[model samples]
Target: MSTNFDEQQWRAELEGHRDHKDDFFATERQSPIPADQRDAFDGLSYFDPDPAYRVEASIDPIDSDDTITMETTVETEQEYERVARLAFELADEERTLVAYSGVTQGGDSLFVPFRDKTTGQQTYGAGRYMEFEVDGEVTAADTVVLDFNLAYHPFCAYNDAFACPLPPEENWLDVPIEAGEKLPDA
Candidate 1:
């Protein structure tokens, strides 16, 4: 119930998730890493878990039946419905990012692809993604946790053979988010 207890629980969960992903990337048959290189694969690079990057934002639903086409790393393109806008504060700055319900998401989860000041520098060049489900009955004014600590690189960042959608400009943030998965070591 204490802030310290909550922080400890969150850090442990995040670290465990990262460890599982490292194992998957290294040893799984369907891993992004080529078979020949799996032996030398250590783990994906990640910024240290920082609680400041975990945030809560209200969902502003997009009431129209509109969609957006996203450019991809390869020839194909992806279409997603702009489901909502999430406004949250990070480092004392108010920021907003669009959330989409794309073909790839199952259930009530929303896909949020974003590029920040860290892109092409500290993290993957194409940007990273976050996904969160709407728990319980949903409403236009619902609040959801946007955990940047769990943001991950697109598959294309690991191998060019897999095409991945680039984040739309509206989701681009001017702030540097110093959390989540970084570009893996070569």
Candidate 2:
């Protein structure tokens, strides 16, 4: 699939959205949680969903010329030996190779927090993310898509009220991912 990321268009959209910080607050004030559901709101201390872009996939197909989804797997705790052996294989100076794994959410969704190489300067200091589907019951046992291009901002980064998940240490990537959303002021 071709990535149609128009830098100028993205920059303009980010800038335009940044200007409406007040509108985000205004809408937040209008949204009320039920008394019984207060805990659900508070319990959502991490990765609160963005009201604007619910869980709906973009109208674009998954593998359209516009966007594409790749598939990979995460090693489960049960596979410690295999993963450990792989890690040892990857303990070299110049380079290393191993079949790594990560959990995914989508069809039984999982939230994998990540900070790409672009953290702090290009993208949000907190981080960005990619979503995927896990096939089984064990949350950690499944396939993942390390699609950097699909990374996106946390709602809080857009407006203060949204609480987003901090990427787990394991999910941090050491490469600069010059894709997805970048700093609005960049």
* RMSD to truth, every model: 2.3, 13.6
Candidate 1 per-residue lDDT over residues 1-186, each given as its tens digit: 223448877989999999999999999988988888899998899988988898888888888867999999896899898888899998788899998887555468789999999999889889999987887634544788889999999888888889899999999999999899987551
Identify the candidate with maximal lDDT: 1
Can you tell me which runs of candidate 2 are displaced by over 4 Å? Answer: 1-107, 135-144
Q: Write the per-residue lDDT of candidate 2 for residues 90-172, one digit (tens) a residue.
A: 11222111221222322343343467566888787887765544444322342222333445666656455555555545556
Candidate 2 lDDT trough over 10 residues, lowest sum: 80-89
In candidate 1, position 43 carries an lDDT of 89
User: How many Å off is the CA of 177 in candidate 2?
Assistant: 1.3
Error of 2 at 11 (Å): 18
